[model samples]
Target: GAGVSQSPSNKVTEKGKDVELRCDPISGHTALYWYRQSLGQGLEFLIYFQGNSAPDKSGLPSDRFSAERTGGSVSTLTIQRTQQEDSAVYLCASSREGGAHYEQYFGPGTRLTVT
Candidate 1:
């Protein structure tokens, strides 16, 4: 009954701090995704989770960025040693299933600011 939702609509953090962003996908959706949008850039795929399979993390920028989806529902994206370059809108999306055929529903991204 709900759409994808991300937490702390806005986050302001220092350059070296760590932050954990949360997302709750629509119930029963078997596929979830994480993306980041930098100023003037297109959405960057960060990760993907489908059902109980191992997540696709090839899109993650670096070792500092990591994510996890627990019980095929809620997901958390953890950014370690945040950097100024990391300041961007973190978006979460979910679909009934994974692949090019399924439509993804997006959330009002969490805006992260590294000061």
Candidate 2:
């Protein structure tokens, strides 16, 4: 069985550019999460999707950040007007439905660099 996966493992773009990151969670997993890790900073939760319920976007830093999960399988995180401060490693994880005690399997992550 496949674990979580992301696309465009590395992205380098000029400031103000828009970037889209993708994530594919494991089959049968109904919970997915997105996180960002800035230099010297801890992993920051961005958003989460649980089955067909509404997504939790409270962790998004700003209006420029948004995400969506389709068919409860794949998700996409879009960043509008990218800035140098947005450079970081974006990680995605997924887990089976088991309340708050389930462990999430993490992907390798996509490194974004805004120059």
Clashing residue pairs in candidate 1 (N, C-alpha, C atoms within 3 angstroms):
none
Candidate 2 regions exceeding 4 Å error are none
What alpha-carbon RMSD in Å does predicted model 1 have with respect to the real structure?
A: 0.6
What TM-score, to 2 decimals, does candidate 2 have?
0.96
Local distance difference test scores for all models:
0.96, 0.94
Over the stretch 7-79, how does candidate 1's per-residue lDDT look in tens digits? 9899999999999999999999999999999999999999999999999999999999999999999999999
Per model, state how many residue pairs clash.
0, 0
Candidate 1 achieves a global lDDT of 0.96
Best by lDDT: 1
Query: Residues 19-87, candidate 2, lDDT per residue (tens digit)?
Result: 999999999999999999998999999998999999989999999999999999999999999999999
Give the TM-score (vs. native) of candidate 1: 0.98
* TM-score of every prediction relative to native: 0.98, 0.96
Give the 10-residue window scoring lowest on summed lDDT in candidate 2: 93-102
Question: For model 1, what is the error of residue 5's alpha carbon versus the real structure, in angstroms, after optimal superposition?
Answer: 0.8
Clashing pairs in 2: none
In model 2, the number of clashes is 0
